[model samples]
Target chain A: MQVEFWFEFASTYSYPAAMRIQSLAAARGVTVAWRSFLLGPIFQQQGWNDSPFNVFPVKGRYMWRDMERICEGLDLSLRRPTRFPRNGLLAARVVCSHADEPWIPDFVRGVYSANFAEDAEISDPAVISRCLETVGQDAAAILAAAQMPASKQKLKAQTAEAMERGIFGAPSFLVGSELFWGNDRLEQALDWAARAAR
Target chain B: MQVEFWFEFASTYSYPAAMRIQSLAAARGVTVAWRSFLLGPIFQQQGWNDSPFNVFPVKGRYMWRDMERICEGLDLSLRRPTRFPRNGLLAARVVCSHADEPWIPDFVRGVYSANFAEDAEISDPAVISRCLETVGQDAAAILAAAQMPASKQKLKAQTAEAMERGIFGAPSFLVGSELFWGNDRLEQALDWAARAAR
Candidate 1:
């Protein structure tokens, strides 16, 4: 069985999920379809223009603390980003346009590392290009392709699909119709996929 | 080490948590101090008159579904409350006034079962009295005690303490200064307490 892992680059929990899902899914023989989608539209529809964490300060405080514990447990590095949610539009567009590419996973991890660990501005083309280059992908051509009208439309459609599927947050895993949200639910999702196969 | 389990009777997730936490904590040699509090003030501080789940329909829908899976895994029966977030003020007053009573745990579980499992109106005195009676306590006497000014003041103070401690929601756990929110974090909170003792 397979699981569709939907993530947004700006999501804090997605960083750990992205870094771990590949190996975890492989161990359970669950193929993962990495689906990069934006939470912008979803939040906007719910009357929020920013991340819910920022919209709710207490939650924002708890989230950072929770992320610190999660990162420590996962042996991942974390730094509070200078910008709460540096625009992930360009990075999302790039990943959405190259979803099926062989270098997508490494590129995904690199973007996550840049945003969370290094606090680099993910919206900056330079940061995204560095992530692409690190994965041995042709950065210049890919960046140009990501800006194409078709690529933009793909991301838009993907986001719409996510909303229609009732995704209210990032790092959601869809095992057929069973939707599991958050990084915490990753193991359960993988187990669900493996069990469904049996 | 000890963990303070702060919960509200109207909170949906608190049902499973109340049912399971005592056993789990006991198994880990962790002492649990049940702290009943209200979410009304906390939600008001965040500019909401209703539960965040209800204010955001998408999240509410997801929450119910998620609860189903969690309850199934825990071997607990759950039925959606007919009224969302039935007033837990009276229940909180009772629990808060008698925080250290030997029967407080059972009383907490009884109230949760009434709201979630039986779909009873938790605000109804008859319902609460029945819960108290089931726990082998004098229903009328305890109910009368719950209405005393002293009882009311105790609940108010407890709720204030929860807010000052950065509790934004119900079913939160505090191990000294470390705050863990949600039923999912119960295990981690217990682990933290257990480790600290060693």
Candidate 2:
């Protein structure tokens, strides 16, 4: 069967989960449906003007260090960003535009690495265009597509669906109606999907 | 080579960590210094009157499920308590009283199992008295000690130290000045302590 991989481009935990989910799911003979959406709107509903990490400084500090150890164990490279919870509006919009593209996985990883590993500004159109080019996709066409009203609506709808499904955080995996949150829970979500399929 | 394991008795993840940490640390020949403290003061500092799980409903739902899966994976039984984030004051004070006892580990595990696995009320003195008795400790003496001003100060000091160490949550492990938060990071914390010893 399939698991819906819900992720936000700006989420720190989503970085590692995005990098390895494909291979891990493949190992379990399970298909992953990548669902990229905005965490901004969800956080807004929770009375947060910015990321909760910024709202809670202590938790924020713990999260960064946790990311360091987590990335090290996963063999993934991570660099501390100058900006806290960099805006992913442009990148997320572009991702939603090409949700069905075959090159999407590579595109997704590119955006994540660019933001987390390279410490680049993902909100910039130029940076997002580079992410598009890296995946062998036409930068101009996809970037152009992402700006369309229909694409904007798609992102909004998916984000709304995320809330409907009780997704409060990024890197959540949906197994049937069960929502498993966090990058750490990826394996369990896949296992749940595999067992259900059997 | 030792790691300070700082945990709040009310924490759900701490339940599993407390049960397995001793054996896990012994395998690596690492000594664990268990520090029981209350999260109430810390949470209040963050402008929260309750656990973050309760502050955020969606996260709360996800956490309960996550705990279920985590417990199952660890081969431990878990029951959803009628009350969540139950008052851990009594439990914490009692744990602090037996900080140097050889039976503290088993006593701590029994208390956690009683709350999370058996869904018992840990806030009640009767329940805590039972936990002390299970470890073959003098319940009357230990409980009496927990009620003392000196014992209360000990719990307070450890909790204050946790905050000073930048510990925002649990079960956090500190190897010297470095802090590792979460039950998932338990092995990594022990590894850090072991590596530093070499």
Measured over the true interface residues after superposition, the C-alpha RMSD of each candidate is: 0.9, 1.3
Cα lDDT of model 2 by residue, B139-159, tens digit: 888788888999889889888
Give the CA lDDT, 0 to 100, for residue A156 in model 1.
97
Candidate 1 on A63-113: residue-level lDDT in tens?
999999999998999999999887899989988888888889999999999
Model 2 Cα lDDT, one tens digit per residue, A1-198: 999999998899999999999999999999988899989999998889888899998889888988998899889999998897888877778777777778888999999999999999998889989988887778888788888999889899999999999999888999889888889788988999999999
Give Cα-based local distance difference scores for all models. Answer: 0.93, 0.88
For model 1, the stretches where C-alpha displacement exceeds 4 angstroms are none
Poorly placed runs, candidate 2 (over 4 Å): none
Best model number under lDDT: 1
- Point to the candidate with the largest DockQ: 2
| Model-by-model DockQ, in order | 0.74, 0.76
